[model samples]
Target: MAEAFERGGQQAWFHDHGHWGVFFHTYDNFQLSGFGEHFDQPRKIHVFIPRDYEVSPDRYSVLYCNDGDDIFFGDGETEQSWQVAEKLSQLYLRDQLKKIIVVAICSGDRHYEYSHIPEDDGGLEEYSRYLAKGLKPFIDENYRTIPHSTVILGASRGGLAAFYTACKHPRQFPQVATLSPSFWLGLDSPSYSMSNLDKAFKIKLQNSALMFALTSTLLEPDLRPKIYLDWGLRDDPGNEYEIRSQCRCMEMIQVLTTEFDYQEDHNLFIVEDPNGSHSINSWGDRLPNILQLFFD
Candidate 1:
């Protein structure tokens, strides 16, 4: 209710406060925030501060996500936005779920940023820097964030970025959730569109190898984040790969888990939703669990 902040902050539910001064933040002087030569000017980042920040006098966990364009809405949400704010509010009513401040930093390059094909170094490292070095510090200084409980999440390429960032910089983010990641990225070739399906498969397979190889270092003893990944096998309407994505997802999960096992303390999970697909709606299903992972 009260159309929390702006439409982009659709899910934010202010506590019993009268809801007078909830401000929707934009890239106002984000450039002046002490970033060195290593940082790039962000297109824009929307910051949502819950109304209770002052009255409650408690530190709230921070949830950072990609694809802000459709994640929040007062109405007319594309049936996929997390609907997280709404769900959590209801849960908060029933029991003891902690409140949180969600920082939805959006981007249009869903594929270019999430996928490794176009990124200089799988796009994960730079993106991780943007968050750990730039965004995360800004939040810590400007807002009260639970340093150890902070989370990063996404779907599709955003999911890939979330997973990559957590693995690459475990100390920065202790929790992560990614749903229906288009692991198909870096693999989708122009040839796939040109009807050369076999060649496309080859390209994806090759890229997948490289991507996983890079993630191997993430599980090193010193850096390990609690990770959650889920996917739907029967997506794409009529997938012709026979035992394609499902089997592949399983295999990849196995790989990641094996690596995590080597670490002394790492919690990694893979939930397979039989009827899920690569979409926002699918990710929304895990909203409750995702929140509890860090907030609770």
Candidate 2:
């Protein structure tokens, strides 16, 4: 496979031209790896271009998906996948959605890179920089995409990454979809060095609530990205982790509705599925609805 572009694009494979819409491209490294970086693994980017891309001169909207592994191919850890390319193709064929490009950015150290806890091995700052600064510029330069039409999306840890990235860089990602986000992770105290573990939990929740308030305040009221958040009621069933996560998710929803002043079914859309769980398949099942909510 030859390097596809000046920056580090290597074509993963070639398909019969104009037949399949999905294309795979790999980068040698996440761009700007030397600037206070820790995770610098090879990046695999899967792009889904609508079939009309070649036939029409029109530029399409872009959807920047995290967890590229779960998007088309399972991450090799499970037999589940989102098949996002196939879904977009179906929607395009049915004329139910406007043409859009899907840019799925695969994860490296998923837990570390997707985390917001800067005190931990969290590399979210670097990872989001790669998305908003590095990858977006590269994609825009290479593809016929609509300017400022990018939306970020993910599930689980990737969901946390997407939400944080959008909140921090709303201009780059003006819309976001977070499905079954691991909100429990954020609920825990970010500091491992804290002396009191019990008090840390309460303090963390209070601080997190305050952080959300600050998050809303920092984001210009007009520039706040449209947010789509969802979680399954039975995410982990009997697991305490899921219980905390669901509670935290609801709490964040409350903050967004009240503090952020987001109107339901308008700029803010949330879904609570009674039967939904924290699995790739569950997130996959909910993806089309998310796409419809944002892109349709």
Candidate 3:
């Protein structure tokens, strides 16, 4: 059963960045409406504001990202951080991209919370409601965000979460970027064998959040969010499982283009990185392009 869509009236306070960096404001142990009942604990929310945000009167587009610790403030050397502040600073300084605010939601029990399909034991729908009904409104109320101009992004399992959230709540997130998403998740087997490729593909297509959203009579094509997908050709090197997963990703892209009529270089953007790997660095490397595609 789906939980009631509700928002916590509790106010969250932001603290100094301290070691994180200048552009970030940290909100520790921030509790969302339904998260306490559904999740393990309150999540740490990080907001990245543009450098001149205070002086400027202009509102900014918002980027909501999963895996806050990895994306926003992981240590530079040991951890493969996305370096969102670094990249955003550079882009803003160069005037290459629009001024944007980033809201990073930290993960807790990520494997469970990020799962999309019913076969997977998780609170994906609850999590999605938390974002759409909980976080977005909070951010809008406190921050100067341009209405209806929000994008959600994530990689791997986080990518799956982002995709599902955007599909379920398109009005809240009109643009979404998924890097090497784990679409093969929740299948009978974690990895697909060559002989069972067809079966896996059918199951995925039938159960896909994107498919459900698009096929619905209520959703118009224009209301569908712009989708960006990227995958590394060398994600798992010679592993047969990774290769088959990559093939599935390609098939999904094809279906989006041919069946859904999502035009390339427009609503749909795909990148196949030959040198990319299934790691934070690779996703970080590709993020700049995504930012440009959506915000520039």
Candidate 4:
């Protein structure tokens, strides 16, 4: 269990239990100049390249994950990461999942990068541009990847961005996983925090309507991504927000199944955690399930 450490502007580590290795590289400011002009600064990119990457010369599916820092480093207080590398190693060794490349794109100004509200300066469109145009090209050129099997994943606001990006560009990303998305973003009132308790029911209704409208208007059945969504019942302990979030998730599931006619446990899967909370740990706990659904 060798701990990861930064050296020479990169974080590198090898798992003693498996042959796979994880590397973190920094893309300097304006390095992606020609890719997209929306984001102007540098970004730390985490990549997990399997051991057989060089020996096999086989093309593998790619999972582009958002909130790279949280996924890799974990929260210092809890030491709970997505445990992506370790889990991928185990799954591959067991022949449960194929050897896939993971590209974890670190967040830069998440509030801006992951936002999806059309009226707000969410930078989501720009972020998608960076992924579809810049990052994807770089990875595909540098590593062997299966273009058709690519998947996009993220949690919370990042989840929102992942779904939005997939909807907008189905040809590039055909699979997606969203964990506890903040679908309540645009519906929030100016005094949302103060009135959250009283407005829980109202927020749920609003979120349902908004999700329906967004999905119905933007998503086409023929181009929909293989989607996975999950939310915790106790997401925000003692707060009504979690319930509202769950409601929103349910609404999205309803629309997907009924409107889009996506069959459950087929092209669409939804997991509801009865005792789960909204945190990296919760997401980590469910990562195995998601991987099985998407990659198994």
Using TM-score, give the best candidate's number: 3
Global lDDT of model 1: 0.61
Deviating ranges (above 4 Å) for candidate 3: 1-22, 34-36, 39-41, 75-78, 191-214, 217-219, 235-245
Clashing pairs in 1: none
Q: Candidates 1 and 3: which is better by lDDT?
A: 3
Rank list by lDDT: 3, 4, 2, 1
In order of appearance, the predictions have TM-scores of 0.75, 0.83, 0.84, 0.82
Any residue pairs clashing in model 3, and if so which? Answer: none
lDDT of 2 by residue, 54-87 (tens): 6789987899989887787676467578877677
lDDT per model vs. reference: 0.61, 0.71, 0.74, 0.72
Give lDDT tens digits, candidate 1, residues 227-288: 77777766464443322444445555656656445322336666777767665666777678
The residue-by-residue lDDT of candidate 3 on 71-122, one tens digit each, is 8668323466897777776776677888789999987668778986665676
TM-score of 2: 0.83
What local lDDT does model 2 show for residue 212?
A: 59
- lDDT score, residue 109, model 1? 47
Using lDDT as the measure, which candidate wins?
3
Candidate 4 ranges with C-alpha deviation above 4 Å? 1-30, 34-38, 75-80, 189-198, 201-219, 235-241
Off by over 4 Å in 2: 1-13, 16-35, 39-41, 189-206, 209-219, 235-242
